[model samples]
Target: MENLNNNEYQKFADKKVPKPTYLKNVILAFLVGGAICTIAQGVTNFLESQGYNEDLCGMGTSIVMIFIGSLLTGLGVYDKIGKVGGAGAAVPITGFANSIVAPAMEFKREGFIFGVAAKMFIIAGPVLVYGIGSSIIAGLLSILFKG
Candidate 1:
């Protein structure tokens, strides 16, 4: 190590780092994300076929998907899926569910109030706040602009 100059050390470090396989990651993300959406769509279609209205079908499907996401997270399967699917597993509503539940599960040893309840919103809290704030602002703007 002492014999190496700065440039030589830098070159050695660069070579030692593994390169990312962008194409394979992209394909995996696409397939995993597509499969998740397909499952949601299937649920929606089934609800619709049973003569439910559009709103009900959409709501039911969301509830089902969130439950599935939470269940998978609890079972420790979602993390593996996340490793394989990358952003594909994370871009869906299920990911939002995972974000809430994962932290709670991790912190549960501290007790329910300080651990699970408090930490449950660690990730999703900011998202929820921003989403609600934006919607409120948009609603106000729409009301003010109404002719």
Candidate 2:
């Protein structure tokens, strides 16, 4: 029996394991993200064509996107998309909905208060906090320097 050093073992394992397709994954992510954004733009355009102003169209688009994300997540379709789409599926508003819903679904057995409700925001709570905090800081700075 021979004892392999760390470097020797790593080399052995490296040869045994196949390399991942990094470029393929990047292209998939790009296509998925671009598709999501394109759909959103289409929704906005459709709304505008219906005689809605830009502001209303934008809000309508956001609402529709969020609803679609939540619906896909609830139906378990978004998980499949995420597994293949990687960051492409994750960089959109639908990804945000998936983040919130995934935890709640996973923890639902522990009761609503402690599990579903509390853990639902585990992924997104920090994002909301910092986002709001930064907006506040930016507003204050603008007021102080520009006002």
Candidate 3:
């Protein structure tokens, strides 16, 4: 009787196990991520052709991408895109915007100061800290080595 029960449980567990689609998911992520980078590159190239210097072109491209990301988030569309794109929707400047906007939108009901404003940095705060910290360290190293 115990053997039969064990066999039944094993069968149930086997049926419940999900087959992994890792390769397919990886391909989707890669394609989507590559597409995003290509779009950014196109924007940069267009700006450069319009007489913008390297700095201006880079900044302009970043602004455009961030704006698009924020707009999609505000319209409740970034989530859908993220679902389909996975990390393809992430690992870019747009992902940073989504990270900031998503939490703020989620907590908007708790009041502005306590909710949206506070939650807006849920992801961005740590990034800002690490970014600034790393820049500072790099700058100090550069100065030290400039002799």
Candidate 4:
């Protein structure tokens, strides 16, 4: 009985196999990243074709993508995409928006003030703060250089 148990344990231990090739992972990452960029390019082209200014077109595209991401987050689809696409979906501006919206949605049950309103800017606050700070610093530098 002892020998039989040891054999059984050995068989179970031997059944554990190593994972597949690194090339497969690389290919999948490449495909997902390409798909994300393709989608962004398509949206940008569509926006430009609609006669929007370059800045407006860019902003519109970002807004639309973020909104779509947020919606997907609400519908629990964004997480699925993240799982499949990994860094592909998580590296974009849309992902930033999703990050902001996700926490707010999750905390929505706590009450509007503490939950929705407060959490809405949790992810975006630092970006906004740094954006303004950097702009101000750049403007000061420009003025100093010009003067």
- Best of the candidates, lDDT: 1
Runs in model 2 deviating more than 4 A are 1-20
- Model 4 CA deviation exceeding 4 Å by range: 1-30
How well does model 3 score by local distance difference test?
A: 0.90
| Cα error of candidate 3 at position 73, Å | 1.0
Model 2 vs. true fold: TM: 0.83
Tens digits of per-residue lDDT for model 3, 1-147: 655788788998998999768898788878878888899999999999999999999999999999989999999998887887788988889888999989988999999999999888988899999999999999999999994
- Model 3 weakest 10-residue run by lDDT: 1-10
Pairs that collide, model 1: none
TM-score of each: 0.85, 0.83, 0.81, 0.69
- TM-score of predicted model 4? 0.69
Report how far residue 118 has shifted in candidate 3, in Å: 1.1
What would the per-residue lDDT of candidate 4 be over residues 56-82, giving only the tens digit for each residue?
A: 878887888888888888898887877
Ranking by TM-score: 1, 2, 3, 4
Indicate whether candidate 2 or candidate 4 has the larger TM-score.
2
Residue 38 lDDT in model 4? Answer: 79
lDDT of 2 by residue, 55-147 (tens): 999899999998999889999999999989999998899999889988989999999999999899999898889989999999999999999
lDDT digits (tens) for residues 8-51 of candidate 1: 88998999999988999999999998999999999999999999
- Model 3 TM-score (2 dp): 0.81
lDDT score at residue 27, model 4, on the 0-100 scale: 69
What lDDT score goes with residue 31 in model 4? 76
Better of 1 and 4 by lDDT: 1
Clashes of each: 0, 0, 0, 0
